[model samples]
Target: MRDPYIFSRMHRIPGYLDPGDALILRALLGHQNASGYRGGAAEIGIYYGRSFFLIERQLRTDERALAIDLFDAGDQKSGRKRLESFTERARDMGCVLSEGQVIRADSRTLAPEDIIARIGRVRMFSIDGGHGLAHVRADADLAAATLSPEGVIVFDDFCNPEWPEVTAAILDFLRANWDRLRPFAVSQKKLYIAHTGIGAEYGAALDRAEGLRRLPRAPVNLFGHTALRVSHRLWQRIGYEILCRMGLGRMSAMLY
Candidate 1:
């Protein structure tokens, strides 16, 4: 299957998505599309539209995307710069976003109804907004409320040392909504989850996808549910870095 975005082109945008994560997300979206799932995509905390646009590119013509972020909020210099760069870079890259698709606000204040009102039910919802436990919990709530029956949620920075709360928040949310949601897969930087009814289906499909290489380790047990850990091999990661340094990022991304 073709990638949602050229690696080199995505690399030019500023954000924390790696090729392996991109590959996993792309594969899941492919599975959804193949299964005839129909819905839009949404993300919290869009840092210059890196991952957001990646998912948007894969969306069908009738589908749409929504993004929420505190661009230029609190008078932070970094936020202002990111807002300006996000606009200019998107324009230069020729990515067309519709009105009200990107919102400049703290996600904590937004309701699921607001999100659904803007983009309808979502097939893929990304939570990379605030790292605090409350923030993550709130974002997860929004995702759950707006998700389609077979929708998936991608949580960033899961189990990262820098943001221990992200892991805690996700675990807490998962346990509370155990009957409704089940984790299906996990990458180094993100976690993939879906409704319990279809979690196993999604996991099994991903386990068979050539784009993802399941790790040798045993499955992760999260509150009686299982999540497969998948990522590129060490050699592929090294090769990707080397090729990018050699100005062959687009070709190197094929490894993912």
Candidate 2:
């Protein structure tokens, strides 16, 4: 079968993920999201499913995995779960489609009832939504409540320079729920592993997986240096942004 993440894996921009985020993702790939003992996997962000591709590599075709997103490329699954029930359709359609358990809705508005009714409790959940105080908080709440007790929550865009508000909300959440939301792994791209688990053995296995050993700086450097070679343009864009932020908007536009 054609790889779903081939384009993204080959073409994502550099500095898009830093050393820490790479480590976190590698470590999360080592175990069940809820805890070391739990089973199954599910992802919430389909920003093309970059992380989805990574985790799916660890599973088989028959593994019960769920992918939830607003597949809103003007595709068919582009509405709330409030409408077409996701499971019944999956069964009728023969459950062999490329997309797995597709839910077309903003996770903030996803109904927990449909989830429990359709796929049962999710083992691992990747929360990459809203990122605002209201939306991110609401999504996080739902993820926490819905995740299996031993499940893990993968948070995306933790250190987005363009969106400080999202950073603030995530930090506040970590502070407020310190015990449940331990910052196991972090980086410039902001992927953190939060284990809401109670098993000592499970926690140890995951804790061991969080490290910087997986980041090979060569790929990104070579890609930028020879392949796409977008570094020059990126530097220019950064300079222009600085100028704009410093009250030189007119000059910045000209420079850009």
Candidate 3:
């Protein structure tokens, strides 16, 4: 049976995550389930709760979804509305709002200790905060520090020309923290990173996912570990354009 939370209802949430990228998220989370990996989830950026909600769906009832964003403090009323909308949607989706903590703060200002104290070690953390190099580096550093063993971190807008700084920051982070984290997979808009010990497992899982077969995979050495990189920009664009035509124009415009 199709999982309503991850597959059906999640697609209805308004956000910039393209269907392809969402599929990647589902596959990674699903793999975690199949492998019995246990830990909470988190996102450094929660705009209208699009990707955040999907991450929430993958959580066990006891798991928390820690979301950090500037919210009304940065985006003003729109950010407030997005948070309100996310709250209502979480309720509708049968998620406990209390378990999903939404913190309004600049991600760059958040220290690793602050996150660890608040949310503990997360298995899956999404970094989609400010696209600037400094901001991305800070978020990445925090994620590396707080991620659990076998946990995966998703970096948003990697290799996207529109946000060149994100790519640069990610590369720098990987280069500096090679022993701590490694890139296992790269979708069109997002890159998946994990601890060196388990990065290969995620890469292998993504390689075997049926939905991601068409996305070309190449084996590469990341931080001395065998990792897989999926570079399929053409397929990503095609799928994203189809989603735009299917009524996600605004979201697609923002993402693409």
Candidate 4:
């Protein structure tokens, strides 16, 4: 069996992930091997630090994490600044970052070579970066190039209309790279992976797509693995409206 560099303590984190996600996480942790792999994890976007805290709880001193984000301002500069501040405020709650853990940058420049020079090949790569076709495709390519054999690459906000490009690019990538990649888990909004396990998602291709669509929304795993990684604030606003009506509005939001 291949090693799966799993984290033991991350299951107890308070936000984002659900019981199902914890179960999946445990499976990842219980598969570690003595191979020379460092087996790391990352989050492309850290909006409020909830997911960062979760990852930090399971991280070792030697294991590195690359948190890619702008942190200052995007379309909603005020919101971005507030989120950046809130993330810093939540540091004391759990998995605190001291220094060098956070990389304040966009995912576009996060090339495969950067992974080599900075974080090395990872065991789990959580992508909540930009949702545009260009950004998602770039991250997918980077993950495809640098992910370890037994590693997992989870995409946040996989099939949202706001990021139509994300859905398009990922579906296209998975179809083309089915031999090396596979989709193992799907909630309502986010899609999880086990690599190679995705097999030929044939006979179940529509099922696969529909399954990915049915994944629990980000308010569930946004803090764990599946992020509400949308690039458009307009769509986010609408989603928030529905979530508010559904009573999931007042929470910390399982943001990526």
Candidate 5:
């Protein structure tokens, strides 16, 4: 399938997310749509609105997105600026600022109650804030408490060498909440998780997609459940870039 959204707009929103990851997001959201799931989307760390906008694009008209971040503070000055830029860009893309919320706060301090009060259970929540172990633990806890039964939680930077603490914290959380959640897929930049009972369905859905199954996969003991780690190799990454420029990034899944 050709993804006009990513090819024509995704790159314009600056962030660390790869195009392949965006494809996975699309697939996951598509599954939710097919299953008739309805809930808000959320992101703990929205640098500008790159991934946030991508998530927003998938939301139904009634669904909203919640963006939590430390905007306009200390080293996040650039982030604050980008956030403003994203607002304008989003407007240009036909999104209303009022459709979602942009909260400027340290996510570690936000209680689960605070989140639920603002936006009920979220169908898709991304934890990408503060790479510290403590921060990751707190974010994970909040995400868990506010996740919908059929929802998915995405942990960013898992296994990334630059943020080794994130991996440790995530594994710890998984071990502690194994009965509550289980990982189904791990991409180059994120790990996809869901309620344990629902994880198998997601895993099967992803595995059945010819595009997704083509990615490199490895067996992983995610806390306790067996899972697949799907990621791009060096050559695949280069090929993805080329395909994206060719406006065929969505089809790059076959390259694997």
Candidate 6:
């Protein structure tokens, strides 16, 4: 089932997740839920709950979702305000941010146990906390440690030139833990990873997902692994261009 909240309301939230990546995530979450994969969902760096909200909406009432951020670590005043903004925005979307669900600390300081204690084993974990090499490595370790046997992790800005360290860190992590974790899919903005054995299962879900345009080209080679590449449809791109010319590019993107 398509999520009305995502198609109609997600654009209003501020963040960097591409629409194509969002579509891919929704399909993966659907596949996980349908296959009876039971575990919590989580995001390490939730900026205003944009991408995190997509994960949160997929959780069962019995499951928990954790938002770990350095909300006030840099500066108490600005941090507190940032946390408040996230909370208010979440509440407006009908999700009340409980004290237990929100962990206000640096991702680097957190051990896997700290996360497991709060949300148990995660089925869908997003690592967008920091773009620095050390930051990505630390967050990746935390995700791998707390991930369920068949869980998946989404890494943001994997190959963006603006953050070359993210790509380097992910490559190093993947090389060290290739047997444990394998990437399945790549969107314009995120890399979808899963347990090496079940990586194909998630990739199949994307292949079967509707409204997503897979590039006709062959799968991408990331290191020794292969991943399917997806992007917006041609019609969607044309619509986006039309909207851009009309000064409604954001709205067009949300709709297309």
RMSD of candidates 1 onward, in order? 2.7, 12.2, 4.4, 10.0, 3.1, 3.4
Across residues 1-256, which tens digit of lDDT does each residue of candidate 6 receive? 4466555566666666655677778788888888999898889888778888888888888888999888763324455577777888888888856788999888999888888888899999999998899999999998999999879999999888999999999999999998789899887778889998999888877787764544332378877778887765677656745765566655664553
Residue pairs clashing, model 1 = none
Write the residue-wise lDDT of candidate 3 on 163-248 in tens digits: 99999999999999887777887766788888878877888888888766655778866556666776556655675566655865
Cα-based TM-score, every candidate: 0.90, 0.58, 0.82, 0.61, 0.87, 0.88
Error of 6 at 127 (Å): 0.9
How many pairs of residues collide in model 1?
0
TM-score, candidate 6, is 0.88
Q: What is the lDDT, from 0 to 100, of the residue 184 in candidate 6?
A: 90
Q: Which parts of model 3 have CA positions greater than 4 angstroms off?
A: 1-11, 73-80, 213-226, 231-256
Candidate 5 off by > 4 Å: 73-80, 210-219, 242-256
TM-score of 2: 0.58
What Cα-based lDDT does every candidate model obtain?
0.83, 0.50, 0.77, 0.54, 0.80, 0.80
| Residue 89 lDDT in candidate 5 | 76
| Candidate 6 residue spans exceeding 4 A from truth | 73-80, 211-218, 233-256
Clashes of 2: 6
Clashing pairs in 4: 6-29, 16-220, 182-198, 187-214, 187-215, 187-216, 188-214, 188-215, 188-216, 189-215
* Location of the lowest summed lDDT over 10 successive residues in candidate 4: 1-10
Off by over 4 Å in 4: 1-27, 30-38, 74-87, 94-99, 197-256
Give the higher-TM-score candidate: 3 or 6.
Answer: 6
Q: Which scores higher on lDDT, 1 or 5?
A: 1
lDDT of 6: 0.80
Per-residue accuracy of model 4 over 29-83 as CA lDDT, tens digit each = 3333222335666777666644554454455667766677777654253544644
